[model samples]
Target: MSISTATVKERSLLGLKELSRDEIASILDRAAHWDRQQEKMSPILNKHFVANMFFENSTRTRFSFEMAEKRLGAQVLNFAAAASSVEKGESIYDTVRTLESMGIDAGVIRLKPIGLLAELAKKVSVPLINAGDGNNEHPTQALLDLYTMKQHFGELKGLRVSIIGDILHSRVARSNLWALQKFGVDVKFCAPANMQAPELAKYAPYVSMEEALQADVVMMLRVQLERHGEGVLKSADTYRVQYGLTEERAAKLNAGTIIMHPAPINRNVEIDDAIVESPQSKIFTQMQNGVPIRMAVIERAMK
Candidate 1:
């Protein structure tokens, strides 16, 4: 399941827009192989330097990227928003330019505003991987989640997957919808009235949480506390009652249906703490797959 370098001609991964199905499959397969043989190979044997520029607070994505690069024998420089020159009002362009001037191999960025990655991509000469951009997308997370699903179900096509929770502010939900739809999965979404995703018409929508939970795969997204300022949700308790996946709610899911989440989970907020540790949970595996998937992405971009 290795992707020959000859197969992927494009040298950058600014977005998922340019990839075809076979290319995506190849990448996922390669990632899976890397994950299984993590100790055996050092793909990035030379001291290649990779920079992580994260504007928003993160734990899983940042660490995952760092582990991925380092495991492949690359050096990693992590720049947190609070510690960086961004605190001095230096613009994103200047920060990226400064890093590029250091001769880094690639940049993994997680910014807040929509289209910021696109803007950054235009300015950087090296490969720019969009770790996240506002509520727009988290392509790497989506790739890992897709890879997790394929591992669980043995295929991607014809699988029914429902993404439930705060869609309006979740980059994970948006990316999952696109990746699932592209991979031929039947995608559905569930959220409270006010928290319904903005791009509803693009994918199947389930007005009730119950309906969405009936799918073969159920994914719960963490509620962004920042969205409370945007008037999207009134209170955490109210959101939990209306849309959270409680033990009773989990009972409604189809038998053996896989449940997933991108981490830093709010226990009893989006999903009950009990369910997160249950056998049905794939949330941790999703986090576990992040490393190899990211490694594959960096390797692909470097070529």
Candidate 2:
């Protein structure tokens, strides 16, 4: 599809890579509208049916998507992979098609495998919101992260954001890099050699934690212990000492720097428990913004 066509109608938010700058701006604008409670009283999505099909366990993303759909006055069908026929050798394509067959307006999915979502995208005509897909991208998470930043700083251009943690498995990091780059937000990744994503070199060369602490925004990624390659974790204590955001390190940051993490935090693993509650931390606010940002996405997508 042409850029113009994409701008008006995005079928599935598979990844931020497919979104143009104008499209990103439009989504953020709509998100702000929801954030400020400026939405119409009449439900924009009345009678629409949406499904949240999560193959992986989640506390935030799955529930937030359900909340977003309901707030828009859409009926929700929640599907858990553990209890579903997915365990019975059913394919992702067949499952999504089954939902579409039931007249579901859209589907939100979080799958463990990387490319299954793209395959489902090809087979289904209804819109799909990627909740999280392996190490690929989490487009809505990036949208809410950007929305949170805008609420605090009012703009993105020229602002520096330092992302720290398990970059290779972080869909959050990849999606944010795409949006940040479009908005002219300078980005740097800080991670141990074992955790850094090499493809992110174009954003900014990987920097030490000490070096990245100087940025306007300090974003921490959850260390994906579940997906770390074999032998990459020699010692958790060693990682914390070198890269984790301990209280001592948090105290050293610029007073004006915004601390963020796309949470389900690993406590003292990615960031210290004390720092997670610090005045500078926007982790909770990021979670709060998820609903509105997701509401905006569902509203725009089903239109």
Candidate 3:
């Protein structure tokens, strides 16, 4: 299960917490390059075979990676846990090893287990990319978010960003906190007491929702309603009044400030339905930006 340090470092996209600023910048720059391409398809990865393995359910992340891989001309294999042998109790490692034995050039994996991706990277010879791993980090999501911000603002330094809602279970927030700090961006969090991630307080301040809306970016996280039992959230209406980006609150934002949400949005829970597509909102832009950013990431792994 042991691997060389060079192998692990060179191939895996485990998380952004360990990546240096320059390393992150390079990925963004590469993503920008990919974004500029007018051609719909490139054969850079022509002969390479890559696998998209997901042990957890996903919609955007799964399809985004698939689109990126195909756009680069890499042969692709898709695996879903619900439809696979995993239902019969096959271990993740055994499944990955089975794929490795089939000659996949690289693997894109999403599993629910925290910290297992790092451990899996060490044991697997082929490079592994983290799709979204159990609230630990969603590096590609952060990468695209960084790319989108850089595209609009021209620089990340000194930019103010407040990530509001569901911080406790958001891998997006964790990944963005680590990556944005590398560029000297001021990142803050805003959430209800029960929804906060206290461990991250040392890294970023938890601000009042009123104060959070004053920032350069108001990034709303999806309210994880499934995690909150009946008593946990009195009702969606209660959460909206206290923390959701209602139209009144959105109207109060500075004209220059932008709105954001990593989607599967709750429509009226975390943000108003009317604001989801407003001029200031980058909700769809984030999804579009994901493809090129992911292209940059998959290219890095395959090449």
Candidate 4:
């Protein structure tokens, strides 16, 4: 698609890579405001329409955004590619343009194409919120993560965060890296050699699992076995022995340190099932936090 030189009028939340510290802080603060409200539904966005155009499958993100939009009283339209014209070979651009032409105020889109969201943003006049764009970024996930950490630790500056697992294929990892670095957090990555993103080496060091476990936050990435080439790693059992947050490894964490994961967890693969909801784990809290953070994002996009 050809890029447009015309000015884009809408305020979109595409990613955190270009967001300044103040801008991110503003979003988090607004999320906190929404979270503290007494009423369940606020009609701040009444009469506005928001369409969730998911070219990829999701449960948590799609539901979370829908919940947020509804809470603020916006009408929503959910689009699933598998059941739509997309399955018949209609292009993604056409699908979004069709919605835009129908007068949707903004779009929440998720897709596997890495740079397609950016290209679509140029072509579409309505605001676009990226649900996830390949492995490039998942901004709201990272924002909720920051909110979860901040709620626990009080301040984020000088915190040490180690993100471990499939670094090469995790949009969560990339989003967290960019957002955390803005807050002066020391971020580290721990993954198998083949799973490392070499381009990010200058931004953060690739550390050993033992070293990663020592941080203030030990965040595990989902082991995307499907994204890996066949035989790239031995097996899930072998991966657990080496990199998974087994019960033994969890015992070694500092009493003050917290464990986290972006879920649809692989049970015993990336992390032991016993440790997922333990006192030290904030895995589920991350999901709960997503609603408000996304509410803040949608409010920003529409208002």
On TM-score, the leading prediction is 3
User: What lDDT score is found at residue 112 in candidate 3?
Assistant: 92
Clashing pairs in 2: none
List the global CA lDDT of all models: 0.81, 0.86, 0.93, 0.93
**How far out, in Å, is residue 280 in model 1?**
0.3
Tens-digit lDDT track of model 2 for 1-303: 222334423756878887899988988998888878865343778878988998888868988888888888988899998999999999777888899899887889999898888877766777788999988999999999999998899999989999998887788999999988999999999988978788788776799899999989999888877665477976667778888998888989998999999989989887998888789999999999999889888997676
TM-score of candidate 1 on Cα atoms, chains taken together: 0.92
Candidate 1 Cα lDDT to native = 0.81
RMSD of each: 3.5, 2.9, 1.8, 2.7
Rank list by TM-score:
3, 4, 2, 1
Q: Residue 66, candidate 3: how far off, in angstroms? A: 0.4
Candidate 2 stretches with Cα past 4 Å from truth are 1-9, 38-42
Model 3 lDDT per residue over 83-179, tens place: 9999999999999999999999889999999989999888888889999999999999999999989999999999999999989999999999999
Per residue, candidate 4 scores C-alpha lDDT tens digits across 180-259 of 99999999999999899999999999999999999999999999877765888789999999999999999999999999
Candidate 4 achieves a global lDDT of 0.93
Query: What TM-score does structure 4 among the candidates reach?
Result: 0.97
On TM-score, the stronger of 1 and 2 is: 2
| Per-residue accuracy of model 1 over 1-303 as CA lDDT, tens digit each | 333333323555655645677877888998988987837458563567789999888877899988888778777889898998899999988998999899787788988888877777766677788898888888898899999999999999999998888787777887787677878999888877677765664676665777788888888888887767766677888878888889998877778799998888999988998999898999889888888898899887765
How high is the lDDT of residue 250 in model 2?
91
Q: List the residue pairs that clash in candidate 3.
A: none
